[model samples]
Each structure stands twice: as structure tokens, then as C-alpha cells.
Target chain A: MTTEMTHTTASEPVTDRPIMTPAVDVYENQDELLIVADLPGVTSDSLSIDLEDDRLTIYGRRKALCSEDTPVLMGGGRAFDFRRVFTVPEAVDAEKITASLEAGVLQLHLPRHERTKPRRISIRTAG
Target chain B: MWMTWNDFDRHFAAIDTLRRELERSVGGTRQSRRLGRWPEATLVDEGERFVFAVDVPGLTQDDLTIDVHNSTLTVAARRVVNPPEGYATHRSERTGFEWKKSFTLPAKIDGERTAANLEEGVLTISLSKLPEAQPRRISIA
Candidate 1:
């Protein structure tokens, strides 16, 4: 599993609000790889997904629950934003990658290159 | 890191005790807090009403149940994820959780006039203040 995943935690950002590392689920099969991330309160306009070389990054900002002036009587520390970085395999076809967001969950589909797919070999009996 | 809003000195002089009750339930440090406050919520007073909001991504209204009493509000939810039929799992970091959390409001509320909405994975519950509990303005003659 170490060979498949190569990622490091974030270094630093100058801000008082906490930035959360969103939880992600990765699934793979012969055809494609699926990545799902949870980012509540983030709309499509505030969410961004970027891929450069083999590193994939996801970023989203959480909308403020309370407007200003109102004191939070009972408060829970709401995370300011959600961000995560992952190292994707080189065999993936970056051109065919697609993504969709619904109900604050993002799904990314990465299809493998045609040459990397498994092939079957057959031999005919000699008469 | 985790920043809690302590803006209590603004207009909430009556609810001064709530300032000390601020939640430090952040980071995986304490076992009691880490396990208790799932889908943490923030309750605020909005003049005539109280607003409660919580982050519940991938959840709908059908998955949640909200109840409001005199000075307490309860929320119960069940989140379940079904994997793909024939897909191989590479990394599974997201999991489902079942929890019921209750919040204490600063003032008395009208339980019969509560409204709840679930939008874009955020659950917002609005509780109206009782007629006698709301503030009233009187103009000098």
C-alpha cells in the first residue's frame, strides 16, 4: 500500500481559523479509480480541484453559519476550509478525468491509460 | 487551530454564564469530547429567534430528527454509506456514524413553532422565542 499512496500532511498557513483535512475514500478497479471527499457547507462555486503532474489537490471553503454581531451562545468550532493533497499514479489518463459535486461531496473519476489495461492471450491447437 | 467565538460581551449580558461554557471539543485530544460531539452544532441568538446549524455532509432531512423544548434542542441522525457493487477498495477513510446531540439554548423557546431545514448538507434549525420571553422596545412620549 505504501507504493500506491505517497502523500504528506500540510506544512503551515497563516491563519487563526482551523483548516480541516477532509476525509476521503478511494476505490479502484480494472477500468478506473474513484475518489470521494466530504466537504459540508461548501458550494460548487467555492470548491476547487487542481491537478499538476501527479499531485492532486482539493480545496473548499465553508460558508459562515452565523452572520455578524450575533454571539454564539453554544458554539462548535467550525472549520474554515477543507483541503487535501494526494499523489496519483502516473498511469492515469489525466485528459479523461472527470469530477462532480453534490450535497457537499465531491467525486473524482480517474481512468487509466489504454496501454495499461490488462490483456488476455489465447493460443489455437495445432492439427 | 480551533478558534471559538467569544463574542459574548456584545448584546448578551443576560446570558453571561454561557461564556464559560464554550466548547473546546476540537482535535482528537480528549476521549470524552472526541466521542460525544459528532456533527457539532453552533447555536446563536437572532433577536426574536435562535438559530442552530451543524455540518452534516451527505445527509438529507430524512436522515435527521430534530426536537425543541423549553431551553433544549435535540438532534438525532443516522448516516450510512453503501459501497459499490463490485469495486475493489483501495483506501477507506470516510465512515458512517450514528449520533444524537442535544444543545442548551440561552433563553426559553416556543417548542411548537420550530422550523428546521437541511440544505447543501447543512442542517439549520430555527426556534422562535416565547411571546413573553422576547424583548420589547418602548418609545418615550
Candidate 2:
């Protein structure tokens, strides 16, 4: 089992009215770290993932589906924008990160650095 | 080098309470739907058909089951959590949940004529009103 993940903070452009921090899940394996986020109502075209100075930021805007005339029988949070940031650890390979968005879920793959990966030890035969 | 939403609040606390309230209400962490324990949903009543939509992110059409018994419509689904192989979890804010929401419509609906589609994580279930339930103009001599 891997050790407890180190929690780091990230930064983003400040905006008024508060930003919705989309729920996120992060997992790490031998080769890479994966982050999955649920961003309902956000489209592929509107979503963006950026990594700067070891800070990874996920941004997206949700277009309102309900119209004015439509009567909303029940009201939910109704947030228009989503934002979340994470500070990348030293083990992460910053150069080779990939992301994809499907069905309102965003998945990010951050590979580990070649030097940081674990290596198997070879046994030598006694002479 | 690292910053979380908590740190951001330390920098500025404007609208902090509002943001927290919104998260609590929208996250569906508690206060399940009025009918029962289900995801947040909205219903729009059009003249011809009524549209019911719910926020079920990370769910496909196959994950849901919709059924209409009498005048009541029931929606049920389960979200599964699958972590990658040899993975060690860091943050786990999004968890799997089983949701079921049902509503009693004012008018009877044609069960066979219903249509449902899942797009961008939103599940839309549309039902057309029965012919007799639809409004019609009666002309008198």
C-alpha cells in the first residue's frame, strides 16, 4: 500500500460571488497519479486544465440549463462556475500530464518521473 | 507550493458562508430530496409534455432505471466507485451513492410514449400527457 497522499494547496485567479469547488478524487499508482472530478453541466469546450509552477488547476463554467420561464419545482445549488487547484508533489512528472473530459467527469493522468519510480533489485550468483 | 480552498479562505473570507451553504445544499451531502434519498432534480411542466431532469454526474443512461406505476414516476440508479489498479487514494470527495427519486404527476401519462436521454451528466426523462389529459377547444353553435 502506498503512503498517505500529501495534501498541498494551489492558487487560481480570484473572482467575486465565490467559485464552486467541484468534488475531486485523486489516486496514485506505480506509473502515475490520477485525478477524477465530477463537473456536471460543464461541457468539453468550457473545461480547462492547467499546470503552472507545480500547481495544477482545474477550471470550468457551467451553462444554466433552466430558463427563466421554466418553473423550477426544486432548487439545487445552481452554481455557474467551478474551480479547484492542487499543488503537484515532487514525484509527479510535470512534463507528461494528460487530461480528458467525458460525461461531465474530468480525468487527469500525471505520470511519475522516470527517476522517481521504484526499481527491482537483481540478485548476483555467489562465485 | 500547495494551496487548498481552506487556504484561499484565509486570504479572503468574502462570501465564504455563502459558498459553504451552496456546497452543502448542492453537494447532496445531506437533506435528501423530499420524496426520499435521491439526487437533486428539477421538473418543468410544459403544456404538451412534462420534463424531469436530475443531476447525476458520472452516470450513463444504462446506470439508471425509470418506471411509472400508475401516475407516479420513479427514478433509481447506483453510482459505482472504481479506483485504478495499484492505486493509493489521496483525496476522496466524490463517493459512490445509490439514488432513488419518485414523483406523483398531476395528470396521467402515456407510459409507452415516454423518452429519456442522458447528456453532459444530466438525465432528462420526458413524458407526454395522455390524449384525454391534453387541453382541447370545444366549439358550440
- The most accurate candidate by lDDT is 1
Error of 2 at A88 (Å): 1.3
lDDT of 2 by residue, A1-127 (tens): 0111112223333654335567788998889999998887788888888888887888888765556676444444344577777889988988899988888788999999999998988999999
- What C-alpha RMSD separates each model from the true structure? 6.8, 12.8
Candidate 2 structure quality by residue, lDDT tens digits, B43-100: 6666567777777788987899999865568889889878767899987777678866
What are the DockQ scores of the candidates, in order? 0.45, 0.33
Q: After superposition, which runs of candidate 1 have C-alpha atoms over 4 Å from their true positions?
A: A1-11, A14-17, A76-79, A123-127, B1-37, B136-141
User: For each predicted model, how many residue pairs clash, with residues at least 3 apart or on different chains?
Assistant: 0, 4
Clashes by residue pair, model 2: A9-B2, A9-B3, A9-B4, A10-B3
What is the per-residue lDDT of model 1 for residues A1-127, given as tens digits with 9 covering 90 to 100? 1222223334566786556667788998888899988877788898988999999989888866777677666664354877888899988999999998887778899999999976777888899
Candidate 2 chain B, which ten residues in sequence have the lowest lDDT sum?
B29-38
Chain A TM-score vs. truth, each candidate: 0.83, 0.78
